[model samples]
Target: MTIQVGDRIPSATLNVLKDGVQAITTDEIFNGRKVVLFSVPGAFTPTCSAKHLPGYVEKFGAFKDKGVEVACMAVNDAFVMKAWAKDQNVPEDLMMLADGNANLARALGLEMDATAFGMGLRSKRFALYADDGVVKALQVEAPGEFKVSSADAMLESLA
Candidate 1:
């Protein structure tokens, strides 16, 4: 079953780029915080690059003002994620997390197979409001749709 609101996020390691090195784990991120975590199918893809991530990047401050830490995760490696963040002109507040091995995605039951597109296993597009490791709100897109989970939409939920 897919994860739902009130589910506790599974303990899994995530690849994070910091100071030319790799830092891993979910605890480092959600131990005791209110987080707005969003996942994309793949980095540099059409909707993900043009709309998904940019939406979060744009509203990052609003999230912070609402006491939410913003994070963007993809199945790509840290190098790719960091480069994509730079390409997207990501600011410092929005964290780019890498689920390179898809372990986290699989744990959350949100893994997607895009092998037909030359991309391997990846994450589906979704967003969640997590407080100290437990989910408070969850929104998963109905495959190829982007209606309710945009950054603005998530912010509206907090209001």
Candidate 2:
């Protein structure tokens, strides 16, 4: 089953590009923090590049003001995620995380098989409000839909 509100984040390594090197961990990122974590199907995909990520990028400052640290995750490698973040003009404030191995996605039970699309394992689109690593709110989109769980909707929930 998919993860839900009040669920504790599974401890798994995630690739985070830092200072020209890759840092791997699950502890420092979410532990003891108020985090807004969102996942997309793939890196540089149409809707994700165009809308999903941009929405978070645009509202990152507001989210910070509300004491939420923002993170975007995809099943791509650290290099691709870092490059895509630059292409998307993702500011320094928002973290672009690489779930290259899909460990985190699988742990959360949000892994989706896209081998038919020539993409291997990937994450379903979703967002969560997590406080100290425990989810407070969770939103998972219906397949191929983007109506809810948007940054705006999550922000409104925080209000």
Candidate 3:
């Protein structure tokens, strides 16, 4: 089952492109912090590029004002994620988490099969408000749908 509110996020390793490839765990990112973690099916897909990811980037300051750490994750490798972030001009305040190999996605039960699309394993579009390792709110989009997981939607929910 997908993670629910009050559920503790699974400890999974995620690769990040710092100065170089660095491995970080879910606990290091989320434990003892209020985090707004959003996931996309793919990094540069149209919707994700145009709206999903941009929404969060645009609202980075707002989330920080609320004392929330903002992170975006995809099943792509670290290089792609770093490239995408640079291309999109992702601010330093926002984190680009690479869930290479779908470890984090599968651990969270949010992996989607997109082999037909030639993308193999990917993460479903979803967003969660996690506080100190415990989820406070979670939104998972239906396959091919985008309604409740946008940054504005998540912001309103935080209020």
Top lDDT model = 3
| Model 1 Cα lDDT, one tens digit per residue, 1-159 | 688888999889888778874776787788799998999998999999999998998898899898899999999899999999999999977889999989989999999998998888989999999999899988899988996789998998888
Q: Give the lDDT of residue 7 in candidate 1.
A: 90
**lDDT, candidate 2, at 135:** 88
Off by over 4 Å in 1: none
TM per model?
A: 0.96, 0.96, 0.98
Mind giving the per-residue lDDT tens digits that candidate 2 earns over 31-137?
A: 98999999999989998988999999999999989999999999999889999999999998788899998999999999999999999999999998899989898
- In angstroms, the error of model 2 at 128 is 0.7
For every candidate in turn, the CA RMSD to the true structure comes to: 1.0, 1.0, 0.7
Report clash pairs, candidate 3.
none
TM-score of predicted structure 3: 0.98
lDDT of 2: 0.90
Please list the residue runs of candidate 2 whose C-alpha ends up more than 4 Å from where it truly belongs after superposition: none
Q: What's the lDDT for residue 124 in model 1?
A: 92
lDDT for each residue of candidate 3 in 1-159, tens digit (9 for 90 to 100):
888899999999999998899999999999899999999999999999999998998898899999999999999999999999998989987889999899999999999999999999999999999999999999999998888999999999899
TM-score: model 1 vs. ground truth: 0.96
